[model samples]
Target chain A: MKRITHFYSLTPEWQHSFAKEMGGELIDNKIIVIPEDIGHGYSYFTQVTPGISVLYVDFVLDTPIKITRQKSDNELYIFHFDMSEHVNLIRINKIDYRIGTHEDLGLAIIDNKMKSTFKPAVGDRTLAVRLLVDKKLLDEFIKTHPSEEHGNRKISVPKKSLYYYDHIDSHSMLLIRSIKDRSVFDSSFESYLKGISLRLLGNFLDRYEHSQAVKDEITDVEIESVTKTQTYLLDNLYNPFPSVPFLSKMAGMSPSKYKMIFKKQFHNTPKNLFIEEKMILANRLLQSGDYKTLTEVIYELNYSKLSYFCSKYYELFHRKPADDLVKKKYNQKCITKSTLQ
Target chain B: MKIIEHSFGPDLDWLPHYAEQLGGKIDGNFIIAPDNGIRYILPCGEGISAFYVDVTYNSDFHKIQKNRDTDFIGLYYNLTDGEATLTARDFMYNVSRWHYNLSVIDGLINTDYVVKSGSRTYGLAIFIKKSIIESYAKKENIVINQIEEITNPEKNTIIRFDRMSYDSYYILEELHKQKVGGPIFDFNLAGTVHLLISNYLRKLSTNKIILQTVNQTDLNNIILIQKYLIEHAEETFPSIKQMADMANMSESKFKILFRKITGSTPNVFFMENKLIKAKELLEEKQYSISQISDKFHFTNNSYFTSKFKEYYGLSPKIFIKHL
Candidate 1:
């Protein structure tokens, strides 16, 4: 670990999300976008090289890095990823920084920088890992995303597992180190995406899940119940939502503590989360072509203000629910009743 | 063949009251009537095969479990919560398909499908078979084409497509529509699957895949292994060295003809496979810029997210939720 001053450009996600509003570029090409959120955190990143020329950012946040998302609406996003492969080397920066989950979320590095990647020296370039995830869906993800436990181990990571090259050394980690931490392209404007390869992740989860801290505190049953609660919230998004007090009673968590844990784990207010859920349901519902106006969705969700609901929907989704109806041109029956084919 | 009785409840004696289908699970004790014969019993949520393995149950599962994608992901979502008024049977019925339906997955290619771009995956997995064009090529006599079968193919390649592609829809509207009879492997909606399989085999013969010693089972494992490598390079480094270490074999022998079996060099395979997770996260718009970066172990947020934008011509976030 070398001590030096360091700066890391915001991952391309910020630009990707705000590209139309704010365009930018990358440095060193060391970063890779994970293409997923850290659930309650911002996103994922990694380091590629052990090069001395690069400046590295400290993982501990004695300092605050200001991050800005599109100023449309408040959205809560969830991302679950694993970085146990890379050796986690926490270093002392002597810099007073408290990294908050509300900001860039969790970032794990693989480099053997146990000493210092950035300190004292004003300019230091550090190796970085990269990842990629969709933004707009994340915005909408703020809505209705459930606070679920990490159960099913599809992709298994070993417990407290860290890789330091005992194998043929494909330098496979090198490629992960290679991709820049920026959004590749916002070219495809897709309203939906299906990940066929998700099944592979099951194994990674299967292996590492046994040792991770998530398993230690919450029970699988508790996680399941949380998921159920989220589902119920989505189903009734359009109706007057149950109060947090009532919801806490239902989930068996006290209202105050539930709010704290839920937000810490999921990074969304229950109400905001509920609104997001209703918005998604609204999308599916509006797709059915039955609801002709955004006003109807607002009415369905039992919002106090129609404009507030519409604006909130736009912020969460970065699009209008009514707009989908206009584009599809098929009324509710046609949209919902279409053959599954 | 007789399908055995599979039901689950909290107690071993709780039987004769419920029936379960393929993958139908309960938050209680598990029961199975094995097709291989005899009754197999285990606790709920166990991955035990009909023989040998015992189900793993713990009071702590509620804490460790995250999200799940199963027929009953919604049912076991919350167990023993006093509000779980509905019976497990009803929930099963809701997500359960009396008979599984097969459809070709279709949507805007990038929107509905994903190709992994990380190290942890096997090989390229087409969400819906891209053999639509090849299927047409086969029917029209393309001399360059041939089909090969996988005996114990890679599980990644063996995955199911949940929707029909637009091309298949075009073929379906024009051709005679009929149900695919017999085994799941026999079904071909637009000949896309068969063509895809054949193309895979042909590629195996000529391209990166080498037959090695011509052993059939190894060939299948190689194919599956190739798929696994192709789909998860970013997240995995199960190289010849890793496997050799696991199996206590020499790396030299492992490297000599490794490519002969899978076709591509391990390094290339690793790179290609990593994309699967990267691409999947890139399309699921719910993730933030940095979230995607860390999932695949991109060292730098700026670099990872930038590469993502460069690869797809849009940031991971914008590309999926396209602004």
Candidate 2:
């Protein structure tokens, strides 16, 4: 009763709450309550009632979810859904209950069976004993027969397939806001989908941070700085061009402050992009077969001073550019090295 | 280069407080000036244009240009990204026919600005067509502030490359993690989107452009691999093992992923690959009974001939000239 904006209800209780009884009454029973409301993690559970039958549920609450956007933050919303994966017993902890919503309780199952059109068997028309929930568009799905598990005809959907159907009303935009534990939404629907997906990855190999304040008040100045910083990286691919000092000056920022903005947008230090940019260019050249020798490629990419470039190249290509160029060409482009298959 | 022109609300004021308060609704031209930068010239007086406000530099009346009284010809806009600002330089390209050349560098306002919203942050200057703006001027003046911006359903969720966030890096690493175990691994079926993320991450990590990440390329590689592996898995077959090694992937990982990507694992995939090879060879069934065995690289001519018989259920020679 503490103004629970999110609560994960058990399958049995959730199912029974909306279920009808013999006397045409909703089964309003005392629901099973759990006090162990943990804030965030993933929890799965399944439970059964003696005559009521078995019920199972799995939910993750307050857990970071990933969503990609092509653009930066032009809008925001929350995502909730009804999904299926069989469970034998109900055993939820604190995770799934945190951000749970009412629609999350039953939408998936309801959507799967509910219909909007009218149709009944002509030959086996029996005096229907009772009416289910709402009589509007939803009631159209009340089965002509109860015990039938799946629909009369099975529509085989493949793996990873998405099937979305809806009536005009009861529809609201659902936003996928966070990933793992980061907030990457900064731009538009067309520019930063992958960026957002990567930004949400908290348990990342490439550690990154998100600042709430900067996002709350994203000024034109900040946008300009980020843009300038990125452009420098693209242009200065093969230079000892700008250290943090030079880079910061280019973007009109203090070095320390520039690091924070860089961390948010690129998920690394300002110098990191420069570093990767070199390796990326070198890799492209190797794949393109531009270098006549390993020494030539190294000198051309200006890795003369830093041994880091070669080591990084080795890491990226899984081999040196000299030895890998022929293989890279054959692999990158499917021009046959041998006519014999 | 398709200039999509549409009218927003009638009360649209592009200049905001910058304009002299023209009592009722003031209509300013919804303008998005084409920038000087573009890969190539594809006509339309403008390049990729967007009508939006630069909320960062926007105060009131900062972005106002000509009044209804002026006969302005053409508009030129400049975007100073360093300040997160957009300023316009309006003039007539052909001033003789079009009377005015008023140059105003007004700061944009009121419209919600987009920051960090692309592959990288870029400053875009949008331009509206002169002819289009002139079409409406005869009846009433038009002022374009910023066209409505779209709200995102997926916000703050991005996957970027940075070596700082340990967790972000970890996700990429896990995706790169190789399973050396034998074929048959658990495949967690998330959804289409999840698989796409996983696939993109893997390709980026491998940095190997073996195949483009299109539906057909991914499908063909799976099919080809599956076909090549099938027939070679005989006796103490090393074909499946060799293929996985060729890919520099764990046998189990390769098998499970291949099955998921296609519908067959290393062994079954090998069988399919082999079956297809056998079909092609069967069509060319000629030469010698013994020579044909050597053609498919079978250990023994009889064995090759026998396997061919098992596969096609017909002797090699008869299956050959029959065509």
Candidate 3:
């Protein structure tokens, strides 16, 4: 049998076989499974807290892999935070959902079989944190202490359900970052991990309970179109910008309907989103020091007038492009001087 | 500014002078009216500390700095209509009401905290020493990299905001309502503080990703609508138009967002919440069937009984009798 390094390759009955194949040992009910000849990645499952456990997989993939796992009997709440730049496909309920880099925080319930294709932008690393919680414990707790204030109205974990948020809030981001921090592996490693795990679960549930109350009213087709519109806008940030009507046509919706759905999905109007994307790209280019001057950045962003570009840059970053350039140069000079010294 | 520090156990001398020292005049235990505001720090156990503060002033007058001797993680619970801003290094945060924030502070860093005036504010601050947290983490076998970073002497402070769970909120409310002081008071205070700490730790662990998918304005509106529903749970259910008007959202958008943020439609959510409250009242066994139904504004006892049975699969009388 071929070695199963990636998660998608493992079938339901392959767990024991794979464990034996990899010479993996179980510690505290957790099997550390390392695939044969896979150098940079390993996956492990550990029961950190009572009735709660985590399946932490970290890998730098060399080749793209389509992984599918059959949903088990027990209900599982999975929080997927992808810290990579590449977009991955997660198909659930016959809808292919796109999980973008750091931009999408996925809260999904896997009661039925599901498949996820992990395709990275060649050579780039894929670092994702997936937290799984037992549904019994969570549901029991919610049943006893129902709070309309906390938005704990009803939690129905269907066989296949997927929820995605565009951005993780600052607090959750910090906590997640803290989990990824490698410095704190002391004697209390297990306790610390459990503590962080439980806290992360609580935070996710709190937000999920509230946000899930507001169901994603858009259909799968609408979501796909909106997602496509978003991808098109991002891809053409530097190209001649398309009008709302043109993009709406691409989405197969009337211009007005398209704008409404797009805004609902992305939280920004098409025009504003386009400008934001351009400004982000421009900022990256400026910070990279690839563009020698502000004029170069303006041309790179396809802006005709330097003043208009500068104003837009100022509006976005609260500083002019020339000022940022000067600061960047000065900072670089200081770093160089320090290195030389 | 005056600084009053009292450690837990027998002596609480600093408690008496606490209000006065911080430019405040006290009416007995509570700080009545102050020239500005008052702060009282009461350290508890090994590495656990508590601070009680109430402020009402027009400007940012008091700047309370943590003593530079110990590094601690601060749990700040703000119960105020006004804003409490904490500025440390590059970040400035507005501490929202009824929400608890966990902050790891480097004693060496120049972190400034000020409560803006024009609103009366009351809150509790619990600070657990990094060593205590480390010790607890060790005992529990928890691996928190943030704790390691926070323990480092050179790193800046870290803060995360989270809402108070219903259980914790009730406990805090109970603690606040307890006016009597004695052995019972001490026991209650200690137990409540421990519960709050554990609650904070649990919250910290389960918060994986903080996604602000809903913008602040919408969130605030949703919160307002929820508060209205909860506060008037006994009253007649408000119409969707009334709720939308209150939230300043269009009726259709409001309905969609309300259901989106809350898993049930407006009427269902309201009815379910009302029934839940009715169950709680029934469990108390204080009120009669007619009184309970009247209180909840149910048209008749039969209607209330039907709804209660639908929710819990048991009649109110049966549930009460079993209890």
Candidate 4:
């Protein structure tokens, strides 16, 4: 993977590497564009404001391609607004986060060398708007528009890097609409794009600042321990999870405090989350067809009886485990018969 | 320190040019300070002129006087690290950091004084024309008796000074971080100016301490009544007769005093308080519209919805949707 810091520097490199695949022109000394190609529809760089830039992408590809880039040390924050029907999975620092259409906005804060991968499906159209903003500029903007808890403190750039998903609001939807609007005149197109882009940015910052304010109230140690507890739960999903007292002790907190803070962060009680994770794991295992029989699946998941496993699975998936196994087997048989024919 | 004077009003488009003449640099819609510090003069609509001063230099006395050719109220906000005296005619008053002052200025007798030195002085000043405020008061159907009194030709140039509250300080700090240009800059500047001015006027209207003639016991009772209304926001508001009995005054006298001290009728004050609380609840997004209306004791959801729209220019449902 190639590592680059500045956005402008990444552009020429992309143009060179994908010379035959994509070609683009520069605009206003700030924006670079790759006009519609044979497979790709359109992609353009728009400098929304002084410190904010947006890359509008619409692509229809013929084969699966994985494009990876290492973002060097810089102060840019990236936001991916997925507008397509399919989910786009992006990996940042080896963790995968799914950005779905109109459901959630993906946020990536790049402070150091971090790897990012973008994979689009073959023969499917994908549309997305990528916004890159200078962190200093955003921090300054947020300071003037202080949210509940983010008033006095400076935004912390975590060492490990961070990626999260935020819910889409109406303002974000408006921004997407404006970006997709193509009737703007060529003469005023740049300014028009800049105006709408900033408005979209303003909307994003408003929500971002409010959430940051809430996050500021949680102490660093508490955040670390909660994260630890989450990992522990995920690792022990098949086994009987530890009690609240035991988990709290591991996290250096009283049981009640741990439960309250855990619920506040994850929006679920420890036991409920344990059950949820177990059900998810069981579903994945069943769909993968690694376990042939119902008893095999139940034993693998550490359930004492088949009935207990089926009951829990039914509660989570609204279907019996045996039904899912039967469905998977029938689907495999149909695929084999069709391929053979 | 450079001293430059220019008369500005609602239609003055050349204000930015004049600002540039005073060692300030004009970049698009923003006026940047040269070497010394930063400054921006934004002419917000409704005849309200807002400007920021962040100058640091060495001088014994640098006076930036606005030769007011029309009736206007000058709101001064001192942010940090500066001491200056405001001298108008025979009266001289000292004002320093974290101080907020409101003054009514007329062209002939009331010359605005801003005494400064060679140290860094950060502050904001908003000049709102008398006509504009009067129109706003009429549109909002709110009483601004203090403004009327201060703008009277017979009255002296009334200068009322108060300490900056924490909310106001936080807002000022936020204003300092605005460095963009173009329509977005203007939009943020106008919104902030309106908010700051509204906050100051709200405080001035409600505060009884600025009224020197009011006795200590009456002032205390008025403050207590204000606090009582805020604490009992969900309860049935007290009638004028009931509140008068509590304050040991006649009903007519209670109504007059309450209006004078709070710059709003008791009923209007209570409604405004409820609306403020409603806005916070709407922002929280935890309750539905019906739940919030019931919690605030509104007669019905429609009535609450109408009142919320009238006050915030947006309905509760729409507001929550935007959130």
The fnat of each candidate, in order, is: 0.00, 0.00, 0.00, 0.04
TM-score of chain A of each: 0.31, 0.32, 0.48, 0.50
lDDT for each of the candidates? Answer: 0.34, 0.32, 0.59, 0.62
Stretches > 4 Å off in candidate 1: A1-341, B2-205, B208-212, B215-240, B247-249, B306-318
Ranking by TM-score: 3, 4, 1, 2
- 2 or 4: which has the higher lDDT? 4
**TM-score of chain B for predicted candidate 2:** 0.27
Stronger candidate by lDDT (1 vs 3): 3
- How many clashes in each structure? 191, 82, 37, 2
Classify candidate 3 by CAPRI docking class: incorrect
RMSD of each: 28.4, 32.5, 30.4, 23.0
Q: Considering summed lDDT, which 10 consecutive residues are worst modelled in model 3 chain B? A: B2-11
The list of candidate 3 runs beyond 4 A from truth reads A1-341, B1-20, B23-46, B52-61, B96-111, B116-118, B132-156, B211-214, B236-289, B299-323
- TM-scores of the models, in the given order? 0.25, 0.20, 0.37, 0.35
- List, for all models, the DockQ compared with the true complex: 0.02, 0.01, 0.01, 0.03
Local accuracy of candidate 1 as per-residue lDDT tens digits, A1-341? 21223223223233333222212223224322321111111222221111111112222222222222121221211122211222222233433221111122123322222222222111222222222222343223323232332333221122311211111111122222222232222111000000101111111222222223432244344555566667778777657778888877777767886676567556887888987777777677767756657666566667778777668778978886567763335555775677643
Deviating ranges (above 4 Å) for candidate 4: A1-341, B1-3, B13-17, B58-61, B68-71, B100-118, B137-159, B163-166, B177-185, B211-323
**iRMS of each prediction:** 17.5, 26.6, 17.5, 11.9
| Weakest lDDT window of 10 consecutive positions for candidate 1 chain A | A187-196
lDDT of 4 by residue, B1-323 (tens): 44555554444565665666666667754566555566667776556677777767566444545554556666777654666666666556555552333333443344444555654667777777777656555644545555445334355444555554434554565556656454445545555565566555445444544543466477557656766787788776789888888888888888888777666788988887787777777656656688889999999999999998786545677666655
